[model samples]
Target: MKYAVLIGDGMADYPIEKLGGKTILQAARTPAMDYIAAHGKAGYAKTIPEGFHPGSDVANMSILGYDPAVYYSGRAPLEAASMGVTLAPDDVAFRCNLVTIEHGRIKDYSAGHISSEEAKILIETLDAELGTDELSFYPGVSYRHLMVARKNLGAETECTPPHDITGKKIDKYLPRGKDGAFFSDRIKASMIVLELHPVNLKRIEEGKNPANSIWVWGQGHAPKFTPFQELYGKTGAVISAVDLLKGIGVYAGLDVIEVEGATGYLDTNYEGKVNAAIEALKTKDLVFIHVEAPDEAGHEGSIDKKLKAVEDFDSRIVAPILKHAQTSDEPFTILILPDHPTPISVKTHTQDPIPFAIYRTDNKESDEVQTFDEDSVKKGSLGLVKASDLIGMLVKAK
Candidate 1:
């Protein structure tokens, strides 16, 4: 049986008053998702484990059937894997973000989603000036970049995610604890180098948020993961625009498929991802398709954009995949859900359980849930399950 896992990243949300007290899932048009819920099993999954931050790295790891407590490392090492940056045993990887700071406040976490080209130039410049024998930087997608520190510097430091502290003062949130000074010093140095650079100057001229400083967080040493095929006995592929997801796929021994125009934003190429997934299923037993647009809109606290993202994901990604499974001769089991809740009210991730639906073409069993939404799925027969068990369920579905 073929398996498909569709993740609408950060698609879950709290009720918004602007949308008549309905969550984005409830307010948006998601016929394809609703159809899956109606014909199959709909329920909630605890994607975030207790005492763990609700980060995508942790959540997606769980969804991929690896317990975060056992195999999970920091977010950057995963991205480093995707970027082909090899990490030594004692080295730590950090997620380096180009952000906008205004009047001593964390103004924009993404620096207005700076283009990959401009970000590449800025990161390369930072590496030239600030990189030492102990520390180095590598550019990735958009404002997201990487910094590898030898000898495990700042591995035990407490650093805040820039998105978690948007618009807040950066003083209290700066890295603190063992070797924290090493990271904080470079962050300050980056501002001096980037603030007056030509890239920032050109961005400011265009009335856009300038990539003025680097915020480093999500640090860890490399992790060990059992290959997906060895663990589940199935060949698989992962398709996503985000480095974190691709990095996870890399560690899991899955094929990472890249699509043209697959930006981790609202303008990401939806059709391209869908096409890639369908093609992958021809040779692979399982395929994971992740969309980052909804989560990006959630972080920006844009209700209309999140609604559009949700609707677009359903119509563009889910509908086409479902159609392919129905028309194909081989039987298919499709699992649909989000990694976590980037609530519009909080503008950050919450550890709340996310709703999920599993539909099987070979065995079409109807559930009581008529639609796919937070409240509607509460009554599903599947009830609350562990996210780490989702892949097993999909694989075992008959």
Candidate 2:
């Protein structure tokens, strides 16, 4: 038996008056996903456990059958694992974002989704100007960078993710705690170095959001996880553009496949990811494919773009993979769902349970759910289950 899990990150949403009171998932055309819902079992999965923040790090961990309360260290450590940045026992890894701050407000979390080439230069300059024996910067994709502090800093410091503070004044959300003063100084110092840099100047000239400052948050030490194969007794692989998901794959002991043009945005290489999954499943027992376009659209508060992203994911990614699984000689099970809800109304993630569906090529039995949306799946026979139960249900059935 073979298995594939496709995640449309942050695809879930609340109803909007603009789309005739329909959620993005409900409004979008997702025939491929709808087919799975109609022909297979569907249900809601609570990816975010109680007392946990609605972050992708925690949610994806849950989806992979790992309990976040036990395995989740912090978002950055996982990304660090993917980047091959080793952390000592005392080091704390932080997600360093090159953000746009204007008029004392957090204007753009991703700094207009700054190009990786440009961001690499900016991060290098920051390291030259501010890095010391204790602190250093490492560049990843786009604005999602990293910083390592070689000290055992307590995690009590309150730091707000820039994406969550979009369009809001950042003064109240600035880092606050025992280590707040040091982080604040570093953030202010980065602005002085980046504000006049050629990259920011050129961006401003082009009427783009300038990445003028570095915002640091999501810090933790390294984590350990039993390999996916060991836990489930199946060879597994993961594909994603974001370092965070790739990082999760790293600790989970799965092969992290990198596609040529896979960006974590609306313009990502959708077809290439589909092709990658198909090839990986030829040898691996399970493959996890994560698409970040819908989530990016949600963060930008673009309803039209989000709707288009959803449809593209269904047709370009879901359709091709489902077709391949159906034609394969061996029996296969495919699961589809989002990590969390990036609701258009709030322009951020929520802790609500997400809808999911699993289609078995060898089983003819199915539930009555006919559409793959937030509301319709509630009537599915599979009902509500913990996200951790998904992998067990899929692999154990085989």
Candidate 3:
């Protein structure tokens, strides 16, 4: 059986033009997605669980058949993996971010969109000056980066993520350690010095992002995954809008291919991504397409942008897949789901269950439904689901 899966970001709600901005799903015209819900089965599924701050790495891993409970570290090590950074057993890692704090408030949280070249230079400089047996800086996407190998150094360190968009100060995250006062102070002090370095100021003047603030958090290590060759007897491939997702795919032994002119931004090759998935289906047994525009737009608090992303994904990917399924005689089954609910209000992925659905000839009688989304799916049979259960459902359908 051929399986096609489309993983959207956040499929949550927001105030439409009635308030100020357009709800992401409402703003765009998703004729294709509309066709899927109309012709195929549509329902809501809890892709994430409560209490856990759901992010892309854990959520997608759970959805892709791997039990996240068994294998979940943090996003930092995945970033390190994507960049080919090796991790030893004693090494500790954290997701590092570049932030601009103005008067104790985050002015430019993403370090003004730091590029690879600028980060590489700054990383090299930091390594030259602060580089030691215990200290290291690994560059990642924009403000979200990684720092590793702090063993035998100290403990009681916390990370200040500039995640809170309009908060008074950055949030501190420390997984676990023995000392609180001693190690925390040293890490805080070192980061403060990095924030005020003269080298970063030069970056600001050059119209590039400043590596002013180093907000390092997300304490986690490596996670093991069961290879698809062993589990499903076929190789798997992955495509994602985020580096961490790509990193996880690489770790799980998947072939990573470019979507062709993908910018990893809003309005990023929407139809192109779907077409790329379709093409990959011919060669690869399993394919994953991740879209981040919805989550980014939600965080940006741009309702129109978020809605457009959802609508476009439906039209460009959902509708086309439905049409193809009607004609193709291959073993085809389609699954559409979101990692978590990134409400426009919080602009982050909540543990809330996002929408989901399955369409196939085998379950056509058992899975007849219409109108997808959270509210509409509640009226149907598919109830709340754990992150680990999605793969089983796919297997059963096949």
Candidate 4:
């Protein structure tokens, strides 16, 4: 038997008035997702535990069957794992983002989705100038980067995610608490270097958002986890474009499959990811496929783009995987869901239970749910299951 867990990151949303008071999922044409709900079991899953921020690191960890409370050390450490940045016992990792600040306000978290090629040069320059014996910078995909601080410097400082502070002032959001001054000074110094760099100048010429500064947050020590195969007895692989998901796969002892042109945005290669998952499942017992485009659309607070992202995910990514699974000789169980709700109104992640659907090749039993939206899935049989239970359920499915 084979298992596949598909995640449309931040795909859940609140009802938008522009879409006739329908959520993006309801407004979008998601035939493949709707079919799963119509023919399989659908319900809500609490991916975000109480008292935890609804970040992808914590949410995806839960979705992959690990308890965040037990295993989540920090977001950067996970990305560090993906970047092959080894962390010592006392080493702390920070998520360093090349962000855009305008008139003291946080304008864009992704700095207009700066290309990795451009971002690499910027981060390397920051490391050479600002890096000390205690702190250093490592570049990852696009806007997501990393800073490792040895001896636990600034590990306890309170920092805010740049994406969460979009359109808000940076004064109150700057890193605070112990070692806050250290992080704040470095972050401020980054602007001087970045603002004058040729990269930012070129970006300005192109009318793109310049990565004028660095915002470091999500700090913690390394984490430990029980390997996926050891815990579930299933050899698995993970397919994603973002470092966080790939890092989670690394800690969980799963193969991380990278696809060309797999950007973590609307233009991401959906076909490549779909094909990767199908190929992985041919030899691996489980595959976790994640798409980040919907989340990016939600963060930008664009209802139309969010609709397009969801529809594209349904038609392009989900449909092909399901088709391949159906034609294969081995039986399969597929589970689909989002990490959390990045509501269009708020333009940030919320701690909301997301709708999910589970389909089995052999069993066609389903509930009254005919669609795969937040409201429609409330009628499903598996009401309000914990995210950690999802893997076990999928593995045990008949």
lDDT, candidate 1, equals 0.94
Which parts of model 3 have CA positions greater than 4 angstroms off? Answer: 14-23, 26-28, 152-161, 171-211, 320-329, 361-363, 366-369
Winner on lDDT between 1 and 4 is 1
Q: Quote the lDDT for 316 in model 4.
A: 93
lDDT of 3 by residue, 68-146 (tens): 6667766677777776788776566767666666665556656665665666666565566655777687765545666
Please provide, for model 2 over 1-398, each residue's C-alpha lDDT reduced to its tens digit, 9 standing for 90 to 100: 99999999999999999999999999999999999999999999999999988999999999988989889889999999999999998998999999999998889999999999999999999999999998999999989999988877635667888889998987788888978888888999998999999999999999999999999999888998988888899998899999999999999999999998888998899989988888898889999999998998999999999998899999998999899989999998999999999998899999999999999999989988999999999999989999988999999874
Model 2: residues with Cα > 4 Å off, grouped in runs:
none
Q: For model 1, give the 10-residue run with minimal summed lDDT.
A: 389-398
Cα lDDT tens digits, model 4, 1-398, are 88889999999999888888999999999999998899999999999899899999999999999989889888999999999999999999999999999999989999999999999999999999999999999999999999999998987899998989899999898999999988999989999999989999999999999999999999999899999888888899999999999999999999999999999999999999988888888789999999999999999998888888999999998898888778879887889899999999999999999999988888878899999999999999999998988898888665
In candidate 1, what are the lDDT values of residues 293-326, reduced to their tens digit? 9999999989989999999999999999999989
- Top candidate on lDDT is 1
lDDT (Cα, 0-100) at 139 in candidate 1? 95
**Pairs with backbone N, CA or C atoms under 3 Å apart (clashes), candidate 3:** 2-331, 24-306, 24-307, 25-307, 32-319, 33-314, 96-145
> Which residue pairs collide in model 4, if any?
none
TM-score of each: 0.99, 0.99, 0.84, 0.99
Q: Candidate 2 clashing pairs? A: none
